[model samples]
Target: MQTDVPVTDRTRVRREPARGRYDRETVHGIIDAALLCHVAFRDGDSVFCIPTVCWREDGHLYIHGSNGSRMLRALLGGQQACVTVTHLDGLVLARAAFNHSMNYRSVVVLGAFEAVPDDRKAASLDRLMDHLAPGRKHEARPGDANELRSTTVLRIALDEASAKLRTGGPQDDEADLSLDVWAGVLPLAVHALPPVPEPGITRSMPDGLRKWAGA
Candidate 1:
């Protein structure tokens, strides 16, 4: 369903019907589930979609890469970009082959991206680390001044976006209801295995990581 919110001229067709979410909740969930997002944008006459790690804070998304990278440079120059996140949930098999589709959740966001200032780099890096592994940043070595200067971070405001989702069993035609087939949704999921520990065994391990040691 498409929402009443006026669609951005660039993504009007792809925009799902707005239903009060402004697609924020749905978009946030997909973004949190995966660290990598594909950002699409045009540089001059060429369109590019690059995959990179990102984090969400307040109502904005932060994406990072090398300062010298072309994509990062273009985005830093205030180019319009479309960032997308998707997760495949299951395979929906219908009674008839024609109506088969996969269960999925996806979100697409459009924004004019810009680079974060050097003064804000430290806080941004901390947020990025926590996004990847909560509490892990405090356990690792702090970033040296030189290392921080080499990275480029772009910020994209979380407005002007839409989300599309499909779920449940497949939609089969009435005429094909009698066909003999296993017609249902085959569920799929992701589960995290315990972490692996390093070889040295001298000091007591943190209680938070007990499971990783087979405890």
Candidate 2:
């Protein structure tokens, strides 16, 4: 059983405290369901927020990028960083315009990142491959020493994270119930399109691709 991360000032959802959840289940669920995260960090006198691919491995959220990337370099300084992931599930239409809002699941993590050692980087990155597509690591060619050397892998513990979510339909005022405007939810999701094969490839779609395509 995973314990809930204690909420800190940074991870606290001030706008609507009722929507915030500090449970591990909610945080992990939001992280696992997302393919992208925006990392916010301070650099010199300025702050930067960068979008990158991310994956969850046990108690950590992992991210990788070129060694030359400024964002990655900035995160390695042991400074506290903020990472956020959001999924827009739907648009809640209300009879009153003021009551209109978006249905979304969002997570906020506040922690300092640490670099994965050279020896552990490969194995750590394998988790990312497995997360993206099971069995894909076996089908894909392994990265060479130079390739690995040019990449940087970092992770932050999920010890100070919180999740905020809004679900269900619109909440219109009783007075607005008689309004002429339509009121309902417009649901949304990330759809996976069919795969496109390489022109010169003689191989058929692999099992992993088939699974990704919902075959």
Candidate 3:
């Protein structure tokens, strides 16, 4: 779905000019690949950024944490927040130090957060798990009333979201082109490791997971 995030010429933050992408597809693709988000919100005079698991469903993003956390409590108080998710693909090592950079995809959402009602909390939790590990929610233990009571789920509508991305080689200045130095990005990606089954809980890892682990 197309986002309502405005891409006014003046509103663009001037840093990495080529890195900014306004297209929703590119933005959402990045969000889907990452499992964590950093939510920044202000409480009184202080600004706090908290890292937490997030899930996107029906054009809204959901995040949860301990009910007693000051960050969640502050968000429940109806504070405006900036939630961001970023994935660093590689380090851009340039011949010139000034041209050094990194390839990344990131999304920034600014909105007013609200406390999800109790009725939808369980479903929200399910979405979060599915976001992190699809189909695993049904296979795992469901949260009990006590566990639910200790958690706070907050939802932020994806209406006002903006995504920016950077890729490709380093951009060295014309003058710096003459420098005798190796200059290129060292590409990086998340490599899946062999699944180490929980010591006491092994029912033969699922085939799909075993394949992922080269079992």
Candidate 4:
């Protein structure tokens, strides 16, 4: 059984409370399925939201970028941030336009960011590569000293988070359901394409690539 995350003022799901999910399994599942996340934070007097690759390991969510990046610098300075990951499953078409909506699983994480220690930075980078392309990390060369010094990895503990999901067919009003119009869900999903190797590559395709392609 999974435990629920304590709901705080910021983590509360206000609209469609029935769609809210606080269980760790559900929240982690959604986070794991997403390849990218939008992180929102305030800088001085302006608010910024930037999209970047994100991965969860152990109990923390990690995102990396060039050391010179404003976002990374700000995060390294201990600024609070909000990260969101969403997967669109389908488009729900209802008889009435107002009732039309999307089927999606989304997670919102609110917390302060912390920089990964220098000693653990390499391992964190490896985990990130594996998360993006499992098993590929072993085949690639590790980051050099300069590269490691030029990059920044920030993490936020998964202490405050919530997941919201909306699934199933369109829910049109009773009167609209009887109208002469199509009302259903057009399912959507992400498909991995066959891998394309770089020019002059001599090594055979790895099992990881094959598995990722569903070959």
Candidate 5:
């Protein structure tokens, strides 16, 4: 059933209330569109915000790292974490310097991460490979038992989350609009360049590999 992510005290958007969003569609889309997220969690007396690969499946967001990693170890221990993903769509230029802004899509998720059971770890990792390049999981060599044992896969519920976005042109002041200056939006996006294959020529590039960088 289609639903919305409920807003909690921490997940609530305080600035520019009009830009806040809590719909499931918006939240899921924003998460899926980004390849990485910045996870903020406290470690001892210091706070750390580290960027890592993130993917969504069902109602949970997933991340992985080496078992010895401090950040992964802290999160898998059920420490509260705040994950954020952002997409900069364009630069909103205005006639007034103070009015200049940016158009972006961002999502914030607050929850404690949990370990994925050992039995389901491989399948979950495969899903991540598919996310980056469809069918690539089958084409590439799979992780062996030792490799899987040394890795830690964790997931956090997306129950407490919100999406905030800004779109279109700038909202310049009435008085500033009359100024003799160029004002508009300069759009931006993630452009996939031609793929660069490895130096060794054992075989041709597979369809799955081509999709990875839009070759």
Candidate 6:
């Protein structure tokens, strides 16, 4: 697990090289912390990037969409794509405007997508549900045959991936450090809000939802 992934021409980090990480842990950590990803792909004269829910397992990233979705259809056709996930930890304020930045972790994955076979779609869907909300798949009814058939799941290997991270206070110029200006980090985080049960459901909140929300 400690092995370093190869840095190919496309995966190399040229700017702020010190912030780039190619190891499995860094890349996977960023991916695991994120629940959504932006996927970009090119089709003919148009370039499209769409935000979608994502999950990872066994060194592969999974995304699901309608079988008739343009993005899914393009990916299922073996188009190359880029997937990116980012976590904004805080906003870095500096005495100098130029030094203002963000404390964050981000990952970029480059690869071609392949459709998950019909036999494996169900399990993948379960994994996705669990990833987003632990224990959800078990508590909810399983997808029916028609539902399964109408959905498309695609996977991309986490092979050509890299994570870039920034942390701590901004590095203001020596002169700016002496300036009388407010400088600090405003921390941010994503947390589950209290659950709002669906209308007409009289049962108590499920253990799964409560546990997932840490409530």
Instruction: Give the alpha-carbon lDDT of every model.
Output: 0.75, 0.88, 0.78, 0.87, 0.89, 0.87
Query: Candidate 6: where is the Cα deviation over 4 Å?
Result: 1-3, 210-215
TM-score of 2: 0.94
What TM-score would every model get versus the actual structure? 0.84, 0.94, 0.87, 0.94, 0.94, 0.94
Per-residue lDDT for 41 in model 1? Answer: 81
lDDT of 4 by residue, 1-215 (tens): 23388888888889998898889888888888777999999888999999999999977889999989999887776778999999999999999999999999999999999999988999999988877677978888889999999888999988899989999998888888779998899998887775677999877777665434531
lDDT tens digits by residue: candidate 1, 162-181: 66677788889988898888
Q: Per-residue error at 207 for model 4, in Å?
A: 2.7
lDDT of 2 by residue, 117-176 (tens): 999999988888887878888888988899999999999999999899999899998998
Model 5 ranges with Cα > 4 A deviation:
1-3, 202-205, 209-215
Clashes of each: 6, 0, 0, 0, 0, 0
**Number of the candidate with higher TM-score, 1 or 3:** 3
As for TM-score, the candidate ahead, 1 or 5, is 5
Worst ten in a row by lDDT for model 4: 206-215
lDDT winner: 5
Model 3: per-residue lDDT, tens digit, 39-147?
A: 9988889888889888777777788889889988888888778899998889998888878988878888778888889989999898876765567688889999999
Rank candidates, lDDT, best first. Answer: 5, 2, 6, 4, 3, 1
Residue pairs with backbone overlap in model 4: none
Minimum summed lDDT over a 10-residue window in model 1 is located at 13-22
- Prediction 6 TM-score vs. true: 0.94
Worst 10 residues of 2 by lDDT: 206-215
Q: How accurate is candidate 4 locally (lDDT)?
A: 0.87
